[model samples]
Target: MRLLQQPWPLKLIWLVLLGEACAALLNREWIVGAVALTTFGLTLLPLYVGRVSGVHIPSGFLVAIAVFLMATLFLGEIRNFYERFWWWDIVLHIGSAVAFGLAGVVLMLILVRGERLTAAPITVAFFAFCFAVTVGVFWEIIEFTADQTLGTNTQRSGLMDTMWDLIVDCLGALVGAAAGWIYLQGEQGWVLTGTLREFVRRNGRLFSPR
Candidate 1:
């Protein structure tokens, strides 16, 4: 069936989360069960968004997001990977910044109604970089709030950790912006370009001139 042929990576992750939730519930670990169940629900977000907004995200993009969620929510937080691995936090921050930067480009394209030729590449890239940095700042704010209010040590080294995260966020955003700029200049062979092109192709009505 067509449904069976959909991306399996996300499905596998959902199944894992479901099983984890069930096991936690059986063991009477309410908090763990709730977290696992919540994560499983979150993995369905792409499908929900598509149904409501009619914006068909590529399966690959959905898989990427699902993997990120699994890493952060299921593995990083639940499995204590953040405490076990020193570099995990850094890698996640950079990866999230880059992902957000690319998302900014896509949002801008939607705002411009896909009139790529009308927008300056530099302007689009700048917006992408700013969007990514802004999201990173917000994330740091959340971490700080959690550490203060919830008594959680998410900030770890406090100011030092926050500063390093912001630094890497900017670096990642810069890379994303450069990639977007290159793609907008009509270059090919880049992964981001292919994804963007696929988005535009699938949502032709969104990009078509009014």
Candidate 2:
């Protein structure tokens, strides 16, 4: 309810989900339809968690996620972009890893600021990297499961594909972690530090010591 009341970017995510659902249903792709709907529903959980925690999630963040879902689920899986464009999956995997890594850093900062934990800058960055890699592993597990159970070729080249994906994920995560470390050192990158500043400004309570 609250999510729907937000601005157009948030609403756009739902609209994309609905379109994906309709496309899947029309094509008789039950698995795709179910995953699309389920993922869309699951995306709301983050906003709910943020609101409960007194964090004002930015519209750009929601829109970024929406674009990711559109590319990954709708285009990659349903439209077979993975097969059509050889680099599509690779690009998405790298982007997802970086995004997750940045999110992990934000989460760590929130926790530390909330008096829940303390850590050195390097430690926090390392945690973010690990968090991204861990998510990547879980995603690969999902791909494996889907390939085995639903007879999908999400794994592509099987072991080789999984290995490469993990490697790329790790590399992307490292980049994010490095950027975060630099930011912590009072340096600025337009996207990373700018976004962090905006996030902190919007939810100062979460980024302030009690």
Candidate 3:
């Protein structure tokens, strides 16, 4: 009952992925099955990490990430959304970069012992932007490698696709960094600040001064 009441959206997404995995395996589509199963596991990662690290991750954040993964791994890759919709790849790249940028902010806070009061917002934002860009570069590399080895068309128009992805990634990272900057400026009322504030609140011992 408690599980049904909380994070039901995530649970529903997980179930759908699981069903896809099972159906794919039954149809002898090994690769599709593997991808669906992997996505299902990825959805569980946040809960697993939170449990292991004693962190309290917001359910909304978890659901958002799960939905993103389902869109990318299952719908985009498996359902040929990238081929059907010209904008699908671009949207996913932006979404991923923004997520990575926000994650980078959280990492910076952890590094600074959550001392946002003393830490420089610009420095944090810069790190987040860099971190997101770096991740985007790595993803492009992976796409290149997969196209070369697995004969996948993930890169689509090759150079042009990669360039556009990087450009959008930078744009998304900038947005995320700007949000982080506002969050660090004590704008607790901001929508994005809510999750970060909750994280800090739940892990006060980890963030509090020594």
Candidate 4:
């Protein structure tokens, strides 16, 4: 049957699972369990939005953001504020941003193909960096607030760690975007067929609407 030919394997799987993982990790030390509740809310955000919007975001993108948010949150959960950050902090660091390129090239590939890299390289690159930097700042803000009000020492380990985390994340985003763009222009094409498009075109009979 044509229904068996739908998508959502690699991309969606990575997104959902990664997001869930980050959420779980951040909540690892929740005392009153409120943080866990908050993380659960975050991890399921896409599902909530998807339910309301009647549309699905690229799983990979969701995963990327989730993981990023989780990274920021995890960084926040340090003990002191002036200690030299350690190296083995992240047990499962995927280096996702710089690796996946803002979900740009690979994401686009998951949708379309044959698109050449643009001449204004800075265009995509800038946005990609902006996304990371912005998210980094946002994470910092969340940490500060958590520390100021809730006294989540674990969340705001300190200034040094927070700063370092932002820098690392920004680098990952910028670099990843470039890599994705480069790969796009190479041989492997973006994924389009057997995706949501085909799902809609075929009258929503693709994946059994789990």
- lDDT comparing candidate 3 with the true structure: 0.85
Each model's lDDT: 0.85, 0.81, 0.85, 0.48
List the candidate numbers ranked by TM-score, top first.
1, 3, 2, 4
Quick one: how many clashes does candidate 4 have?
15
Better structure of 1 and 4 per TM-score: 1
After superposition on all CA atoms, what RMSD does each candidate show versus the true structure? 2.1, 3.3, 2.6, 9.5
Off by over 4 Å in 3: 1-5, 25-30, 114-117
For residue 192, give model 3's deviation from the true position in Å: 1.6
Candidate 1 lDDT, tens digit per residue, 42-142?
A: 87877888868888888878888888888888889989988999889888888888888888888777788745456678988999999999999999999
- Identify the runs in model 4 with alpha carbons over 4 angstroms from their true place: 1-41, 59-119, 154-157, 183-210
In order of appearance, the predictions have TM-scores of 0.92, 0.78, 0.88, 0.48
Q: Note the residue pairs that clash in candidate 2.
A: none
Q: Give the C-alpha miss distance for residue 75 in model 3, angstroms.
A: 0.4
lDDT of 3 by residue, 1-210 (tens): 234645779889978998999999999999999999999999888888888888888876888799899999899988989889999988888888888888888887778874545668998899999999999999999999999999988888989999999999999899778778988888877766777777677877766555
Ranking 1 against 4 by lDDT, winner: 1
Tens-digit lDDT track of model 2 for 1-210: 386577797687788787878898999989889978876876687687777887777766766777787788777876788889999988998888988888888888877884756657797799899999999999999989999999988887989999999999999899778766776777876687666667778988777887
